[model samples]
Target: MPNSKPRANSLIELHKPKRASSVALVVPLKDASRECLKRLARYECPSLPPYPKSQAAAVLVGLFVGRWGDIYVLLSRRSATLSSYAGDTALPGGRWDKTDASLEDTAASFAETARFIQIGLPIDKRRVPLLCTLPPFLARSHLIVTPVVVLVTDPTLRPILNAPEVDTLFSHPLASFLHDRAPFPLPSSSPYHDMPWGPTRVRLHSFLTGREASGTKPIAGLTASILLEVAQIGYGIAPEGFEADAPGQASRRERIAWELSRAERFVEALKREGIRYDWTKEERREREKRLGRDKSRL
Candidate 1:
């Protein structure tokens, strides 16, 4: 969606720099899209056009000022009872129902509902922070998911999980995802190979935020890809001489290296924070065992 929302009036200083007491994150509504586009301009990322034919869905990339004055993104763990992607970590989102006029509206509605449930503060439409839509990604279910990035200013609010859809919710510093990590190489032939847009297969990266320590799960699939792209641009870590071109046969290795370098930076950052590189195979096996036992009891 375009950043043409009317500027916040005197009652709320939505565009001003945040003060400790202020509970809302604000930026000049006009600069919202401009800032997002500016950040993404360095890389040859392709923006998805309106996909009326595809089922439109959107995820909320909710950003908020943390207790320590750090900027963090709100994430949630799905309940195991769900039929699809059960117990997976995700951003708040769902299909664009008839009630939503556009994908952006769909994202805004979900964000408002989720934030209200997580935190006690009722969302004021006028105070909604800068929002910009990012490139769409394809989900495992084949739905085209759009990510709406929003900046949240309030720090007093805390998560109160909506247990049916979300088992729990947590916030991770936006900077943490920006740290270097290793790219998760994909098999040569994958679902992403036939994309109608940019690179068919850019090496995927891993962001191992300290989720396990807090009992929160890791984010994977399309959600992880979107976050990585957002982190690269939002945190200004894109490499020099980056071009927005389809990954060519000859330049494939170079492209992979480029993606890996960015990830390596995130890996180093995680080290500094004392977070493990990746979830251990033993941990995965233990979790699977627990799940198996829980199922047997049921």
Candidate 2:
């Protein structure tokens, strides 16, 4: 039998992801906090006027300065033991608990579990401070997810690996999301399908990041979508060549607004609005064509 520690190290070497040679950045280490604060300061996060606490969800966008001064966002691979979305890459967060005073609190509390347990990061409030929340995003599950941005200040943090809920912890370059040119090795090779979401088609992206620092997995779906927005917001710039968002499209706030204006619950609203947030036959075929393959999940 092989030693587990050495086996793990060998796996990391086997899957090391391609490093981006040069990624344009407006959020360098020194300015990561300043730039994010400045950008978010100008914009107001819109409230979902209709949903109650039971319907709210949140995700923590934990950012830290890497050893080389580039800005990175923390991610985790859900433990395969989970019933749903198991083994998928996700930002640390979950549905809002009744005890949570606000979505930001829900995001922060979950983040503490993910960061501290996964990496042995200390419980010091000074190390991880919630910056602000972004506009709410409707998850495929129909619950609205609010991304709470936080900056990790300590650089010398060590690995702890005690996470029972997470199989691995990894970081991705925040700025790489802005470019369509495959800034981080995988390029657009990540399988994707432009699924119909209403009047327009939105891309359902699946990025294979290879074996990254700590542990890594493919990032896709709403998680990928959220990071794209975060990268744009943190840097105060749109994606380089492609549109991060469709031009003149109704803002996500506006999309959610349509639900509030109606009496329908979010799930019902998607059905009533002729919106296909999940893949239908249209997307299934496209995905197969794109990937030349696939699977089924519960």
Cα deviation at 73, candidate 2, in Å, is 0.8
Tens digits of per-residue lDDT, candidate 1, 115-198, equal 346333345443445345665665545455667766654444455666777887777655445433333222122213223322
Q: Could you give me the TM-score of model 1 versus the true structure? A: 0.56
Q: How many residue pairs clash per model?
A: 12, 1
Whole-model lDDT per candidate? 0.51, 0.59
lDDT tens per residue, model 2, 1-298: 1111211111111111221122222222334434544464344565444454566777778777665555678888888888888888897666777677765566556555543455455554445544556778877676787887766655566656555777878888877776654556433544456666553456665555656554566678889888888777777787665655443344565445444434357546556545544423433444444333223321
Single out the weakest 10-residue window by summed lDDT for candidate 1. 249-258
**Candidate 2 residue 106 C-alpha distance from true site, Å:** 3.8
